[model samples]
Target: MDCGIILPSVSPNSNYFSVHASPRSPCIMVRCQQKEGQVKNNHHYNELPLLKRKRPTMINIPVDRSLENNNIMNTSRVRVQEVEVEEDGYGVYSKKGISRTRLEDRYSANFASDAHGKSKQALFGIFDGHGGAKAAEFAAAKLGNIILDYLRRGDKSMIEENIKNGYLAADEEFLKGNATGGVCCVTALVQHGSLIVSNVGDCRAVISKAGVAEPLTNDHNPSREDEKLRIESKGGYVDCCNGVWRIQGSLAVSRAIGDQHLKQWVTAEPDTQILTIKPDFQFLILASDGLWNKVSNQEAVDVIQPFFTAGSNKPELKNACRKLVELSISRGSNDDTSVMVVQLDKFAH
Candidate 1:
């Protein structure tokens, strides 16, 4: 069985050259198999001339490693869904897990520059969906823009309020769609040397300060005392199911953007904070529970430190993000993993 771009099988008798098939973009895999009689009757191979080589030869072909790496990262059970890199600052990587038959993780990364081409602001988000991918996909595509629009209308002092409003606004829009399921979210906004971080679910943001890991947002799980109290106060219940605590015996997260049935208890109001970007800040990591459940915050920072700490204007952040997700998968996480890495120094100015 072969997988790649949709193409008809080549006739061995007519084709004098080799045809190499590779996936250029996200594509479907189709298996083309010949029947026993077809293979037995085909004499095309015998008609082709063969030349013996004394040794091996290196073929000089320009290759796009981004595409190649994406393919190489996929396994029979796991699929690499997305790989995006902005050499100027950040990169993102997401993969479907072995336990899940589909990918339910989505992400967004946007950077704004000033008239002089200087980096002025950056936005990063990770959305992890449960029940379905619709909520995550909707939030990933629409939340950043809504938040940035709010930020444009306010000053740094109002960053917190703007971010919160953005989350609520996006939630309202999504709820109007009558979508089922919900998405855990984490967003990082950088502007005027201040890093604003926000979250409403298990998605997390962590920053590396001179090689030390500092969490920017806490997971809003039903297991938390505050979260549990909030849910119960709203006439909801929290129960432990199979060793995992869940709200109302349904969702594991206490807050999110959708899940209309649980909207009253599972609010979309994000906890927001602002931190001044300093020289000590190395980089920031935004990821879903897929990575956090398996990899510790310090472990994640340590694994990617060498890449950012290297004195290079263009660090290999793409590879760094890829390695982090791979590490999580290796650690027995059977959930979709998404990771985004941003070099702090790039936006420090």
Candidate 2:
């Protein structure tokens, strides 16, 4: 338990100093002479005292090597695995009535060190799926790897290209497996105080800076004029069959991955943007439409502000995701809910 460096030294002619002994304790005390740099242990001497009359100085004492190693191992083993999930029918049907599934998949990686040995880089992502979990799982497993690989390849402008390529690749893989689900994806890579974000579908990415929520990616929906124009221009029309424009009356989102039917008319090219993380940039929020459908970006940021500002004890990011999902359910959002909150300071090495 006493795992530390202790220095013990005595003069050639020292008076008798009593040392205490514990019952059957496994303790080793190493004594070293400053001039000789030699080490020795006195098994019989339970306590070694330092006298003011001694001219010899002990630079360092070797404590229990095993104890010190154990302490270091324990410290290095500390890590955080933050994740959560929830699902509810909300007075709709029987046990098999609503097949509502909430999938929250996230990935966060930070460089242990930088090239100049001063700054570090961090990467994060959140994938929220609606129709099925395959898309979300796919994005969670592969997007971060793709982005990191691109960065490692030393392509300065490859972030956006890599994101677009990753989305398209996931779409292809999903279609090959006969999975018909669609997902809203968002990714952020932070390097050298800059952030590059890419998003598709309704899952949103919002940056909270200076107490204001600024959206990083626009929602690709039928209601947006830009999306509407893009969809219509590609020979696609958004028809309001159930009070909302649906692609060909089947898909709700005008843009998404793995919607083969929709993909025929609409592609999965994500909207990408690069941002600078100034002192004002506090955090970023990424979540599926389930959270955004019931809560605005500003409202969601407000709901999770306390967690981010209250230091590092709480699992703010995961808790924020859970809270957002709970709020969506309370607000009668039947769709699956997922949220991801990332703090800039947490990634600042």
What is the TM-score of each predicted model, taking all chains together? 0.76, 0.65
What local lDDT score does residue 92 receive in model 2, on the 0 to 100 scale? 7
Give the TM-score comparing model 1 with the true structure, all chains together: 0.76
Q: Which parts of model 1 have CA positions greater than 4 angstroms off?
A: 1-86
- lDDT by residue for model 2 (158-226), tens: 667876776676677777877767667777777777788888777778888876899998887787888
RMSD of 1: 9.7
Angstrom error of the Cα, residue 57, model 2: value is 70
Question: Number of clashes in model 1?
Answer: 0
The TM-score of candidate 2 is 0.65
In order, what lDDT does every prediction score? Answer: 0.79, 0.59
Q: Which candidate has the top score in TM-score?
A: 1
Per-residue lDDT tens digits of candidate 1, residues 238-332?
Answer: 99999999888888999999999999899999999889999899899999999999999999999989996578778888789889988998889
Candidate 1 Cα lDDT to native: 0.79
Off by over 4 Å in 2: 1-119, 311-315
